[model samples]
Target chain A: MSVAIVFDREVAERWHLREVGVWMFLGTVVMLFAAFTSAYVVRKSGADWVPVHLPPLLWLNSVVLLASSLTLELGRRPGATARAASTAIAATCGLALLFFAGQVQAWSTLARTGVYLPTNPASSFFYILTGVHGAHLIVAFGFLAYLFVRTVRRTDVAGWPYLAGLVSTVWHFLTAVWIYLLLMLRLA
Target chain B: MSHSDSFIRKYIFSTDHKIIGIQYILTGLAMALVGGTLAGLIRLQLGWPGLQWPLLGKLMPVGMPSGVMTPEFYMALVTMHGTIMVFFFMSFVLVSGFGNYVVPLQIGARDMAFPLLNMLSYWIGLLGAIVILLSFFVQGGAAAAGWTAYPPLSAVASAMPGSALGQTLWLLAMALFIASFTMSGLNIVATVLSLRAPGMSMMRMPLTVWSYFISAIMGLLAFPPLTAAAIMLLFDRHFDTSFFLPSGLIVAGKLLPNHGGSPLLWQHLFWFLGHPEVYVLILPALGIALDMLPVFSRKPVFGYRLSVYCLMIVAVLSMIVWGHHMFVSGMSPFSGEYFSISTMLITVPMTIIGVNMLGSLWGARITLATPMLFALGIIALFGVGGFGGLFLGNATADMQLHDTYFVVGHFHLMIGGVTLLGTFAGIYYWFPKMFGRQMSEALGKAHFWLTFLPFFTVFFMQHFVGLQGAPRRYYAFTTYEYLNRTHGQNVVISLVAFLLMAGQLVFALNFIWSLVAGRASERNPWHATTLEWETSSPPPHGNFVEIPTVHRWAYEYSVAGEALDYTPQTVPARQVAVTA
Candidate 1:
């Protein structure tokens, strides 16, 4: 007796389920940062806190991050021509690299000012926030690089749009996270 | 695709979920032995202070020199014991092991959503366990700052003997464990949500799947805070960042350089994950009992929708009730009252679950299967444990019983006894499907009675000891005049604990013997009405050769005018009507 099992793959609803998994993961990442930020705020209110000056280069890094997010979202448009999408994807990866380099510069500037991690709680939070955000950005960069390679080589192009869409969503989310972290550091 | 394939592909590097599940089960059982031995050492020092352990003293001259355990050594054992039991034994064996083996089959899916990711999860969890086990032989013993590892003590290396490298290893091990859990939890959630059979709606799924799904969601959301906390703790220990270390702290009469950190930050982060984790442990156990009770009693489960809603209610309430753990930690009176109310409110839904199980069993032909006995045991024991929580949940009462043996008894009855019994039931219920062999029912029943008797004897005696104000985590209570009067109870509890350890061997023997030489089993050995029993015993690589189309709810037992007493979820309406 043969029984036909109608899996969700045919229902065109499988992609939505995968997207739910990805968003659930991103939700966890949000909580991790939420915990860190809450701790940062509480620790800052302590009597011995010494606030550090914000890095001048951090503002430039934010612009780079925001621009990359825009380019990635444009690349995700279903109606975009292949050449247009490729260019946008390439530019997004480049801007992400520049943003990473800008963060390194900010760290060096802080070290030069003698505001190292042990200087005070403020400097500690600055390094920790930027370092963790940079780490996630690197993972996003690697993902975008994979999409970049696939688009350029035209290998496995059938899966290109979906893969690019996932990378774009993550890249955009990280961009927002960076802005939030920068604003938090400045306001505090 | 025969059994004679290469060993690596068949067993080691295979992406088969069944093999991965068995791998988790065996590894967890082995770690339980290690965790159990650590408990033995802890009980030894607690019962007979400074008594020389004749065999162990010669083996480890430092920890138990001349057979007499030191205070620090006793502490180290205590820390590792809790860590191993909670993370390795319970997390791996009870949740991941059984969940991996059962979820896909019960959902009528061919395999996990991501088979390779499922394989990686187990290996990573095993690596985390090994890293923690290695901490035992490290220079400072094994993280004696307690399993919670709170700071200023945990922040400074010189604060304790095992605070240096041992605590660092503990943090790393825990970080890896969180990673593994997050990955596995995602897969379970994804599989359950998307991979149900053709007609299996969310409500149509078995209570086991719902429990596993809810528990997985809890793990996915809760583990990240602990990961973040572990990273911060690592920073405080090594980089002198002082995330958990406050200003003007002095350890060992030396003024510390660290400043501007709040220790309460660690507690908030820890308990956020820790309390939800209690639900993560118990929900699966509750799921197992709820799933098994109807089958044994030959009746439809009472108030199925109510049972599911109660689980959802408990899950949400458990997240907010974490502050109850901090009632005596100088928290505000208002916050304490809030937490107290939330904690007490949880018992309402918990009571509903217990009543539903009893209601289903009422006026029914109850079978005395070994798994049924364990399922019923969980309800009785967990009910008592739930009542005990009210005392601790009350802010006023908790002030006196904060770190007493009463709190210890409460958790052991709930997380310790109930969860372990639930796992035993799952093992017995699924052993046939897992290995195509039947466990000795006589041996299984005997194992339950032996384990049940000794378990209560050890943990129940702890409540009276706590009433006498014998505080927890102290290696020797000789310093307190009131505690000396409780020494006789301590001896009895410890002796009974050893008997509990011995009782586990009956289970071990049955489990091992069944795998090798026991009688073979057939499909639906228990005449159950679930998707898992619809397939052949020890389901093949793709689960079902022709995937079933589930037509009704999981428990459709004793439908009027039917030929059989039970109707499987896969049976179509036409067939069932014709039979009726």
Candidate 2:
């Protein structure tokens, strides 16, 4: 018998349940950040709202995230050997981690420049949105790490492509959400 | 769920939707007792002020010092009661529990799209319940700033005793609940959307499935804003960021260090989820009633498409009506008018749904089964609750009625009454399916009358006292000279409330007794035409031996020239069968 949670006898053949599930999950992530955006706009309109210049490292991290998505696409290109596919995915995960390290670096850079969380409303929102997005990335990282290890071990390589697609969607979606939050802070 | 799985794997770490569903229902039952005791404490303080029970002092020494319930303690009880009843209890049983057990089976699927996530949702939710309950044992009492947790009081720790550690724990617990609800709701939505059996078109699915589908989607859309609010509130309380706490003059004659913050922003964020959160409970109750109306009335559901449309419309309207709750929060007159008009517009679809049910029951051979009785009761009580909304929906009218017993009364009927009736109806209706035994009809009928009568008296009296200007959230109304008559009504409401609680014992004992020794029933006891009835009394692992193909909509009762009164969705069309 197949897994109780993961498999159905007949329905899985008819539709991409995993893709649909990922799409629905993205809807919620969108709402969560949408709320943060609204709160930012609302709080920014108030007095004592001092906007802080974000650290320059964030631009580099954005490029790193964009690169990670690219390497993910590269890994899935046709005729890639098993070893090559594994190596590409490993590179993508490494870049994703580097991107997070860059985020922490940006926070420290802000702190060194005399901008703390409770220093002002804009600073507070800046810390919050970044912190929340990091928390979600941590969860995504865990899943992606599973995929990385699976490709290395190749125990579930047969189904790893399917799993890889789902995780990739989340990874790319978060990358887009980060860009949205980044731009909202910068422009809005 | 597999036969080869061990007891620990099959039952404890089970990913089976049925087991997870029972976990939700049973946890909700336990929390209901806790919530009910809190209510009893509230009524004791309000009904007969200063009445001391030494046992109470022994039970909770901090909240009730020397048998006297403190004002802060009363506030905590009120907050915890509302929080527990609405979020913990109702959402668990009706929304997650019923949705989990019924959605997969009724839609003719093996299990939820993500059953592992379903299990995770239940466990995380249980953790949240434990965290909230643990707040009572902390240095301060539970959250006192109302379940809404409107900021300034909720944000500032030293505002009250419960405001200290308890409120922080409340936010943490709420964050946990929202996370769990997010996962569970997504699972429900995905299952409904993607996992239906072949030939089970969206319209062919039962209203029970439709209601739950809409409720899950609505919850998924609505909860995140509150998540955003909770995150900020936690920051405000712990980090002193002043997200919801404005620059204040004095707290104990000392100036606070917080800067500019808008408490109204918290209201907007909280109610964005809070308004739909009410519908999250109620729309399912309405759905439960809508589906059952066909079963008991033995008639094709009146306006099946319209009922589904009404649910969809309500879901959309429920999102926008969050502002109606902020009418008295110093909103601009123009914004208030906009919110008010949109809020009233919900009643149009709601009224249509009600009329559809009444029309379904008109001149039909109604069963008057225990489930039917509770289902009918939900319809009547909902009408009363909806009528009260008309008064509160208007900004000018709510100016007098906001925070009054009238507002309290309206919600109690709509949320409290409807959920209570819906829970029982669902339990009775599905008991045979869940446990494979029928509950006692005599006890069920007795339970209905006992609960229904007092439910009417207790809440209905609030509307009267509210009209007379008796405010809510007070420690005791007896202290006010103008509220002297209101105190008398309070006592009556209290006494009847005791009866209403006592009435639930019948259901409890009936549930327990029926589980082991109630009358044995067949697979389809109701003779209903839903897909769930087509399976075994207790459906097995993966729900069906073979995936059943749906042929028609769920409600095909008393057809013009059919051999049977009802036809299961699995049955093929006569024309198709003949051609084959």
Candidate 3:
């Protein structure tokens, strides 16, 4: 009798799980940063705050992240060719790598200037904000790379557009979070 | 997985929601044993301070040297017990266990929206459980900073023996738990949105699904701040960042190297998650009771819409009232008043829920089933717990009661007793669908009476002693003159707590014995209305021959002029009319 049950996979196809999941994930990530931002505000109000200087390279990295978002979103627009999408996806991944490189340069510059994680509360917040943001972006990058491979190889493109759409959603969110962290760290 | 799949594929790696659900329930029960033992140790120290226990001495020579439990070891037991019971058992079983098992089948969906994520959530949660368990044998013993793990004591390794590696392991386990919840919570929310069967509107969905969905979102949004705080705490401990440690602190007659940290910041972040976390632990259980009550009473649930609204209202209000937990801290008076008012406001929705439960059971053909008894226990106990909470939620009353046994009693009655009873009801009500067998009614009723009486007695005595200003987390109750007066009460509570623990064995035995030999349950054994009972007992993979089109609301029982006492949500209205 159990064998009589026949599940239709078609009904499940309409399930926009990827989109729903990404949105929920974005909510969690936002809360994490919100906590960090609140912590920064409270800590900055304390004595011995000793504000750290913003890295010059961080400005360039911010542009790189913003540009990557534009490229990914443009590639995922309503009517892009598969080849164009593949190229855009790979380019976005490359640009993300460049952003990471710039962040590393910023960190090294801070280290050269005799500032470490424990140097001052300001420096500690600076490193934590950037480091945690970078950690999240790295996961986004891996997924983007997977999409890039799929688009390039044409191996599994059944739901390429939907997959690309989810990728872009997360990509843009991280970019926005990066901006929020930058502003919070600078303003506070 | 196919029927012919390998054993590992069928059981271990199976993405089947039912199997995953059973896995979570069993794992939670296993962790409960560990937690219950920890509770036993705590009671032993409280009841018979300096009492010799050579058996425990052999197990932990450092903690129980010469058969006498130290202040530090007693603390570790307290920390792990709270940690295990709250996170591993209640949260695990209610949210993940029943969420996975019941949501899909009841909603008429085949499985979770993201089955792989659901699987990962369970395995990751298990890894977290194992990590916390391993913390016990760590160099300095298990974490002793209480389950909350407030800082300075938690930040400085030299502060205490348990603060060293055990605290780090505790942080790691907590981080893993957050990640797992993020994964599972996301899956539950997405599944509810993306996978509900046709005709099952939001209002048509079972109360259990709504409560689970609301609770999952609460966990998802609330847990991250705690994650953020854990990261900062880790930095303070190892990297000398001093995120939560104050600058002028002196530990063990030594000036600490840390400077410029606010321990209050940790409390804000912790309770941000911690407060909503209370709702996350109980809402699903509450939903379970509300959903099953109608089936046993043979009456449509009273004010179904109001019940759902109360669930959401309670959830949203729970998020904002977190500041009440901080009233005893150095918070401003204005903020204290605000939190106090917000916390008390929650009682309105909760009162409405209690009223609805009683209203649903009013003048009904109340069956004396095991699950029904547990559901009744939820209403009665949760009602008392809710009223008990008013004192703690108010700033004027809570300031004095803070950290007292009153606080302990309040939570035990609510999160501890009510949630556990609710979870047991879920297990008993759904046992037929889960395992194709009916648990023994005799044993179940016995378990309920034994557990309910002792559980009520123990916590009630705690409240009495607590009102006498007996502080909690104290090593020796006999040390204080005021507390010494409550010595008799402490012994009674301790012995009753042991009885509560022993009663759980009946449930365990009933569960195992039923799995092997209980009578097979037929489809819709209770003549229920929910979609889950419409499927085969021990539902097959994908749950349905074809996903059912839900035709009506979940609670349809004993309609006037109806031939059958209940009409399942799947039955068309025209068919019901013809039958009538």
Candidate 4:
């Protein structure tokens, strides 16, 4: 008697399901920040509003985030070898940590300059928008760390690509959101 | 494999979608009891103003002082009642519970796409409910600034007694609830998009699954703004930030230190989510009615494609029409007009949906089963409620009806009536499949009539009472000379409301009795053409022993030359050829 065998489904096909879930989550995050920014704009137009200069470290933090996005893109490339992918992931995690440090420095700078949370409308928006974004990045970092550890151990390489793809998408979207927030704060 | 699992794994912490759905339903039922009790208290206060509740005063001494219901407590009852009913009972029970349990089965899938996430969503939702319930025991009492919790009242602690710790806990609870809902919404969308069984294409899927899918998408898009608003309000309450607090606000003879905030900002953010949230509550009910209508009428759903298109249109229109809620709240006239136009536009698709439902029943061999009667009941109730909505939707009329009993009447009829009837219909239709036992039809019909009459009697008259200029949210009518005439009507409404509550006892009795002692259900008791019927009664954990392949649409009823009136989606073409 002859028997037929079927191989397991590919990672991309399965990842499509996970990808849909992740994108929907990102969509909500975008709306959340949009709501915050719009409220900030409305409040700024009112009386008793005091505008404050944001700390310079925010620009450096933006650079770190952009760099993290680039490294994740490099890791997700199709032809990248295992060692190359691990190196890219390590770089991504390092840049993400650096971005968090920069954000903390910016907050400290604002605090030192007497721009406290309740001092003015501008400062409140500053703390709130960055704090909310930082919270989201904390979750992203946890996912990235998982991806990094998995890549280093070479565990389930077939599934690893899909996880990498999801992490990359989230990182890039957050990077774009940060850039948007920065410009909005600067110009609006 | 399911049978061998430990008891705890099978019942308590199981990742089975069906068990989690049951958990959602049971939790929602428990919350409904609490919510319903709150409503009873509210009606009691309204019916006999200044009358003391002898027993309740001792039990809730903090809220009811000296046997009389205090104004603050009455407000808390209103707030908690709306919050629990909308979030815990209506949305959680009808939308999430049914969507989780029935969507996967009806669409021929074993389970949700992310089963673990589905499990987590239920637990988080339960945690949120527990937190909200706990808020009532706090020092300041439960949240009292209305369910909307508009912030000037909610922001300052001195504004209301319940604004202190209770509002904070309320916000925290809502945040957790939003998280749970967001996760489940993602699960539903992903599952429907990616996990359909073979040959069950988008068009072939049941209307129930489609409505769940569309509502999930709406939830995903709508809930985040509410979360954002909650966080901003939390900051306003505690961190001395001024998100919703305006300048020079005086509460209890003290000027609030907050500045540079717009109260309208909260209104905008809230209604943005609020309008779509109503659709989120009703679409599942509409879906239930649409699905049941076809099965009972023994006909293909009238304008199947049109119904789908209409749902999408309603969803899109629901988003833009939220501004209608703010027309009399001091929003710009132009913007209010825009909202009024958009709000009226929704009736076009709504009318189409109504026509299609009525058309399906024309000249059809109807089965007046328990589920069908409830479905017909929904049509009548929803028709009345939808027309009441038109009166409130018009900006000109809304100016007069804004804060009156008319608004309350319109809202309760539209949301409360439709969801209640639709939920009963679903419970009846799915009872056999859910428990492997049939509910008694006689008790079901009695429950429906009793509930239907009292619900309409209580709410429909409120419109006329409101036109008399009786304001809502008032603790007593004796204070205002003009409102004193409304007392008699209020007495009648309250009496009818109590009767409605009593009628639900029949449903409880019938459900409990049928679950244990009713007749055993066959595999397909309703002669339905859906995949869920192809599975065993109270389907196994995997849902199907062998996955069935679909050959036709879900509503294949009364086909010519067939042995039976219905042809299930799972039937193969070869069987029909041999029969012919």
Every model: Cα RMSD to truth:
3.6, 3.1, 3.9, 3.1
* Candidate number 2, chain A TM-score: 0.89
lDDT per residue for candidate 3 within B294-382, as digits (tens), equals 99999888888998999999999998999988998989999999999999899999889889989999999999899999999999899
Model 4 score (lDDT): 0.87
Going through the candidates in order, what is chain B's TM-score?
Answer: 0.98, 0.98, 0.98, 0.98
Q: Candidate 4 lDDT, tens digit per residue, B346-372?
A: 999988988888988999889889889
Question: Candidate 1 chain A: minimum summed lDDT over ten consecutive residues — where?
Answer: A1-10
Residue pairs clashing in model 2 are: none
- TM-score of A-chain in each prediction? 0.90, 0.89, 0.90, 0.92
Write one digit per residue (lDDT tens) for candidate 2, span A1-188: 11112444444443377778778878988888888888888889888998889887899999999899888766655556667778888999999999999999999999999998899999999999999999988999898888778767766434656677778889989899899989988888
| The candidate that achieves the highest lDDT relative to the unseen native structure | 3
Clash tally, candidates in order: 2, 0, 0, 0
Q: Note the Cα lDDT for every prediction shown.
A: 0.87, 0.88, 0.89, 0.87
lDDT per residue for candidate 1 within B162-193, as digits (tens), equals 88788888888888888888878888898998
Per-candidate iRMSD: 1.2, 0.8, 0.6, 1.0
